[model samples]
Target chain A: MTDLLRTPLYGLHLELGGKMVPFTGYDMPVQFAGIMAEHQHTREKAGLFDVSHMGQVILRAESYQAVAGAFERLVPMNVLGLGEGRQRYGLFTNEQGGVLDDLMFANRGDHLFVVVNAACKEADIARMRAALEPDISVTYIEDRALLALQGPAAVDVLAAINPAAGEMKFMDVATLDLNGAQCWVSRSGYTGEDGYEISVPADQAVDLARALLAHDDVMPIGLGARDSLRLEAGLCLYGHDMDEDTLPAEAGLVWAIQKARRAGGEREGGFPGAQAVLEQIASGAARKRVGLRPEGRAPMREGVELFATSEGGEAIGKITSGGFGPTVGGPVAMGYVPVDLAKADTTVFGELRGKRMPLSVTSLPFVAANFKR
Target chain B: MKYTEEHEWLLPEGDLIVVGITAHAAEQLGDVVFVELPEVGTEVTKDEDVVVIESVKAASDILAPLDGEIVEVNEALTENPGLVNEDATGGGWFFKMKVSDAAPMDDYMDEAAYNKFIG
Candidate 1:
């Protein structure tokens, strides 16, 4: 508590009656009005999130092609083929075919812009510097603050200030002006909502956030709502959902690996763990992540062991991320299970305390995504 | 009304003492999503965890304030758990217990003392 860092909007959060809690060494707002209220507000309206804790980086080389080519060596995604002004989800893999970290990278024409999880930022920066340094410089953008304006009304709220926001399609990244601040805006977010993530100068972050929050439809959302929103969206939370030992195939993230980087595509097998990852892709992983819907109202939170039978049997899997999904109106969870039990409608059991409660294997995105095409 | 260190409030009425969490406890717990009440006829001892209360953030237990037998529990909590957040002291009451010995109620703190204890 003594050494925890604070975002530029830390004071603003307290001013709005936010409950501050420690998150990844930073003191962040866990909730403002209330978790349930803020969550419902974000789904019904617009939510302003201070994501300044996340790492923003710039990877620059002589050309975008050079940087993309260098970055392609570390990730499984098709980085070299990424179009300028567009962003794509990516992952860094290890030699064991496990994921290092999941991130979003945008081809900014002049350089590539990367946003990584706050917990993995330091290691990610070190990894990039070691792998693509000197020739391709990895610059951590510390002077900027990131804010995500999410939900259905997020577009109109942001567009009212910068009309260009309305023109941007999902995954589009561009440099736009918002309330006199030059911001790197992306039409993508973790919440599966049609929204924009704006990167602004640290000094101007508070003003821009205040400007967006001034709209009647916009409310200040904290990390608590942010987690619930993403959980309902079927999005993975880095360390909880996938980690250094979890393969992309097992985590069900193979779709992000474009055809060009797969087994027989244009640039086949250059990334770390390409062999193991491709092998799993060709056949199938032993265990796979699946959506779990507990039959009862009680949430089967993270670390709750799952069983094959309701009453007995050895632990088959473990819930990775679980909580009451506000929009789903019930408990939603994600966990790994044997491939046979990973399919939707399969009946599984989660052990709550001493009882084995029934849970149905379900399709993800407990609530449908509201992303704009 | 008497209060315990756990933030539970007890209001004596005849032989039964109504039990519920204070507004401060409810507020700290955030939004209550589910409540698992003990059986009405179950005998309870002081400090025994009886009610299982789950909010969006975490799960907590409501302990028995004194040795008693649970006579009645508010069934409304099963359908609308938010009642605990709306009116913790009134409609949000957990259960009514007939105390085996009402003398222990004297050791509990009053409203003013409980308020100071929280501070």
Candidate 2:
């Protein structure tokens, strides 16, 4: 087998007894204590995650507005309206009505910084470089390592380390000196809880992780818990809930598209595949991504076909992502089903092995989000 | 103790052999959330899947080894499945089955060989 890439926190993850596994070509930690325990720890106290494998790119230009307009051409989100020090979720759609990847972009008052999924980073960077001008440089921050401190105690733990972290609000980003290294800290994360994503210099990543783990409430978590936490938060896993054939509206990411890009808006359908995406927004998506809560103890899994009922029922949809949600105390999954079946508490059936189990189409986010306002 | 390459452990307990996953398998599987096993009295063949273990992230199938009919199962796992995580090979045994006949167990490993295989 080919060797997997290791993150900057590789040594530390080993030291903290992280169960390393191959994830998206990276030899990443899947769990430390355990998936359920680490998941519970993040929900109740604080969890420190090494997300250095994610792609962090800095879009440098003469001004933030210049890059914002160029960026708005790639995704459906209203990048031009984003204020300074503000971050917004965006999607890169292809020429066809499909989502290429989901990303987080921040207006740093001077330039734009975007973080995309680790697996799609190189492709995303290549696409941006080909589409933008030479002066509008897109540089991937290869020297930086990202860490996420999430949960109820994340804020207090961060503020204790850097007093400036206390001043930031949700979706706020600021470049501050964390310890001795210059770092970009954002008051946002994938977990439903209030958290911060800190982009620190690669050389000092170990020190930052050590500092966060020192807090009594903070425990080192791994990818296993991260998946469960994000699922409960109703966030989409790029390749799972969305893909090259999945549209933004169909993936339940319509909120990411501002009114400016919708039909009858000021700047209608300016991004790639605008015609199809805008039309879907106006008429509504045929198949929408919705949360599914399986009834009973058996947790459903991905690729399990969905049926109308247990008794020779018609096929409706298939589960894209399914797992046991620690917080939800049962099986929670996300899939694209017909819009008629996407309503609240619409009972569906998940075909597992040979038997079919009733799976209800609950709303997104099995657990209520606790994002800091 | 006989170990399968799939990480299952079959302990020779006289005629009623007990089956469970190895500790290495449990650690790799992470936390076991739910386990669905075949009902007692169901006939099974050697190396056939008879139990399904669900972790928080993925599901794993536990295969039967030299099996005939399932006699008993670890019912405690239905409510407290974490037992597999706590003690995978001991009290966390999945089920007990009456062996039709011990097949040519040449492919399976002993405890010492299994340890080296995992490493």
Best prediction by lDDT: 1
The residue-level lDDT of candidate 2 at A280 comes to: 85
- Across B20-93, the per-residue lDDT of candidate 1 in tens digits comes to 99999999999998898999899999999999998999889889999989999999999899999999999999
Residue-level lDDT tens digits of model 2 in A199-280? 9999999998888898899999999899989999999999988999998889878889999888877888889999998888
Sorted into a CAPRI-style docking class, model 1 comes out as medium
| A188-220 per-residue lDDT for model 1 (tens digits) | 998878899999999999999899988999999
DockQ of each: 0.80, 0.79
For model 1, the superposed segments whose C-alpha errors exceed 4 Å read none
**Backbone N/Cα/C clashes per model:** 0, 0
The window of 10 residues in a row where model 2 chain B has the poorest summed lDDT is B99-108
User: Where is the poorest 10-residue window by lDDT in model 1 chain A?
Assistant: A304-313
Interface RMSD for candidate 1 relative to the native interface? 0.7
